[model samples]
Target: MNLLIQLTDLSIKTKQLELLQPLSFKLYQDKPVTILGQTGSGKSLLAQAIVGLLPSELSQQGQVEVFGQTHDRKSLISLWGREVIMLPQEPWRALDPLMPAYQQVSEVYQCLHDLDEESAFYRALKDLERVGLKSSALKRPGQLSGGMAQRLAVTSATAGGAKLVLADEPTKGLDVSRRDDIIQVLMNSAQGGGLLTITHDIEVARQIGGDIIVMKEGVVVEQGSAQQILNHPQHAYTQLLIAADPRHWKARDYPMIEKKPVLEAKRLAIGRNGLALSNGINFTIHSGEVVGVVGDSGCGKSTLGDTLLGLLKPIEGSVKRLSEEAKPYQWLKLFQDPPAALTCSVTLGVLLEDLVKLHQIERQRVAILMSKLNLAPELLERRSTEVSGGELQRFAILRAMLLEPVFLFADEPTSRLDPIIAKEVIELLVDLAKEQGCALLFVSHDPYLIEKRCDTVLRL
Candidate 1:
C-alpha cells in the first residue's frame, strides 16, 4: 500500500492558544479515513492544516508528507487541483454564484485538465448526471437548494481527478437519500486514492467505513476500524456522540392545551423566479405548535418558509398573520448558514448588544438564555467567523429568541451541529417556543427528528 498523506506531530494554534493538539496519522491508498467529532473539536482545523489553507492568524507545526514527499505551503499550492482537492464544509459558498452549475464544473475540466470546451461540456454533463444533478445543471448556486448546491460543488471539485480528496462535512444539509448519493459519489471519486473526510454526521463516518478517528477538545480519544470504533467505542465521549443520533432518540411528549392560530396559508403557490414548485398548499400553525416540514432536496421546503415569512411573494393566495398582538420584530428566521446571517464587521458581542438595545431586552434575560443554550460567554467576544458552526448557530438562536418571536422559521437549524449538540439545540428550541407560545416552522431532512419533536408534519 502507498501512503497518500502522513502527519508527524502536526498541531494547529493561534497567537493566544492551541487549537489542535500534536497528532500523527497515516492515510494510505485505497483506504478512506474519517474524523468524527462535534463542532469546535478541531476536526476542520486538521483538514485545513493538511491542505495548507489555515488562516494567517493560525499557525501549524511539524511535518506534512504528501504522495511520498514532504512539502511546504509554497510547494503545496502547486499540487492543489492535480494532487489534492478539498470539498469545503459550506459547499454553497465555495461555488461560483454567478455561473450556472454546468458551466462551473465544465470550467474545472477546461482549465485543470486542459480539455476543449466541447469535450469538457460532455464530461461535465456525465458527471452531473451521475450525481443526479443533470436536471439542475442550468441553475446557479444561489438558485439551487442547499443539497443541490452541495452536489454541484462536489462534481466541480473532483473534476480534476485529484487522488487525495479532503471532504469536510460534505453531507451537511442533504436529505437521507441525497446524503447517501453524495457518499457514493465521493467513494467513487476517490477510487484507488485516499479519502480523508471530516464530518459530525455519524452516518457519513459509518458509510465511508475504513479507519475512524474520534476527537474531542482537540485530542483524539479513539482510533480503529469504523466497525470497531462506531460499534464498540471505548471512550465515554465517543459513546455519547453515537447515542446522540436522532434515530436513537426517544419521542418527546406534549400535553394537550388550548391553541390559537398564529399564521395561516391558503391556496398557496411557492417558488422562485416565476416558477411554481408546489401549489394548492394550505396549513395553519397555532401558537406554541411545532410544525415540521419534510421533503426531498429542491422540493420547495425553503420557498414555503420564505413565503410565510413574507421574504418572498406567493404566486397565488395569501398568508394571514392571525396573531394581532405580534409585532414585525416578533417574526424571524434562523438561517441555514449562521455566517451568512451574521455580519463579520463586528464581534458577536456587539451584535448582541445592538439587538438588546434595539429591543430593550433585559440583561438578566440575555444571560439566562445564554446559559440555557450552553453558549460560552467568551464566544461573544469573537466575530461570527471566529466561532465554530455549532456555536455560531446557537448564537443565531439566541438572537432570534431574544426577540421573543411569535413565529420563527428555523431552516435546518441543526444541520451543521453534531448529534449531541443538534439534539440539545432542537430540544431547546422546541421547549422555549412552547413555553413562550412561539410557533416554530422546523425544516429538516431527518424524519426521526421531525417525528419526535414536531406537533404537526407538513410535507412539501
Candidate 2:
C-alpha cells in the first residue's frame, strides 16, 4: 500500500494542554480515513499540526511523514498547500472577510495555476457551480449561509491542487439534504487522492466507507475498517458516541409564557444589501418565553439575530426592547460558528473581562455567571483558539449573561455541541429565562431541540 500520509508516535504539548499524545495514524492513496473524537478530543489540533499551523510555543515530537518526505517544524510550513490542504470547520473564518467569495476562490486557483483574473474567475465560477452554488453567491462570505460557506471552503481547498485533503467536521452545519451532496463530493476527492475526515458523525463516516481511527482525549483508542468500527465498536467510547445520537433524546414539554410583548419588531425588513429576507415581518417575544425561528440554511436566521442585536440596521421597521429593569441590560448574540464571532488572539477570560468592563458589570457577578454556565475558570486564561466549539458557545452565552440582558438572541447556539451538551445548553437557557425573567429568541434547524426547549415556535 502506498502511504500518502503517516504520523508515528506524534505528540504535541501546549502550555496548558497536551494534544495528540503519542498518536500514530496513516492514510493511504485513494483511501478515506475518518478520525472520530469527542468535542475536546484534539481532533482539530491534529489536523492543524499536520498542516503545520500549530503555534510556535506548542512543541511537537516524533515523525510526520508526507509523500515519503520527513516533515519537521520548518519544512512543514512551506509544504502545507503544495501537498496537503485543510478545510477548517469554520469555513468562513478561513476566508478573507473583505474579499468577495469568487475572488477568494480565484486566489486559490491563482496560487496553483498562475492564471489571470478572467481565467481564474471562470474556473472559480465553474467550481462554485460544481458545488451547487448560484453565480450570484459571488458575494462576500458574510452573504452566504453556513452550509454555503462550507461548500466554498471545499471548493477552495480542492482548487489548491493538493494530493491530500484534511476536512474537520465538514458536514457539521449542513442540513440533511446538503450533507449528502457534500459527502459525495468529499468521497469523490478521496477516490482521486487521500482524504482524512475528522468527525463525530458516525453516519457520515459510514457513508464514506473508509478506514477508522477513533481518538479519545489525546490517544487513538481504536482503528479498523469502517464496517467493523460502525457495526461492532470494540471501544466503550465509540459505543457511547453511537448511543448519544440526538434522535435518542427524550422529548419534554417546552414551557410557554403568556403573550406579553417583551420585544417587538414592526414590519422588519432584514438583509445587508436591501435584499429583504422576510418582507414586512412582524413578531413579538414575551418575557419568560423561548421563541424558535426555523427555516432553510440561508433563510435569514442570522440576519434576524443581527437585526435583533441592533448590529444590522433594518431597511424599514422598528425594533423595540421593552424592559423595565433598572439594572444595566446586556444583549448576547451567539453565532452559528463561534470562531466567526470570536477573536482568535484573545483568551476567553480576557473576552469576558472586556465584555464586563464594556457593560460596566461587576467582576464578582461575572465570576458567578461563569461558574453557573459550567465553564472551567481555567478556560479564561486560554485563547479563543484553544477552546472547542461547545466551550466557545457556552463562553459566548456566559459573556452575554454577564451583562444581564433582558433579551438574548441565540443563532444556532447548539449547532456545534453534542446531543447531551446541546440539551444542557437548552436547559441552561430555559433556567436563565425563568430565573432572570429574560426573553430568549433561539434559532435552529434541529426540530427536536426546538420542540423540547422552545416556548413558542416561529417558522421563517
- Choose the strongest candidate by TM-score: 1
Relative to the true structure, how large is the alpha-carbon lDDT of every model? 0.91, 0.78
lDDT of predicted model 2: 0.78
At residue 260, give the lDDT of candidate 1: 93
Which predicted model would earn the best lDDT? Answer: 1
Q: List model 2 lDDT by residue over 1-460, tens digit each.
A: 6898889888899877777789888889887899887877778888877888777888888888888889876787776675778888878668887788788789877777899888998988887888777554557887788777888877777787777888999988776667777888777766668999988876788898779988888888899999999889999888877766655456566455454567789988888777877757788887777888887666688888888888899988999877655343556676766777889887777777777677787788877777788888898889888877677878877776666667788888877886556767777777877667678888876666677667788877
Question: For candidate 1, lDDT tens digit of each residue in 148-255?
Answer: 989898889989899999999999899998999989989998998999999988889999999999999899999999999988999999999999998888887877
Model 1 misplaced regions, further than 4 Å: 14-16, 55-59, 346-364, 375-388
Model 1, residue pairs in steric clash: none
- In each prediction, how many residue pairs overlap at the backbone (N, C-alpha, C within less than 3 A)? 0, 1
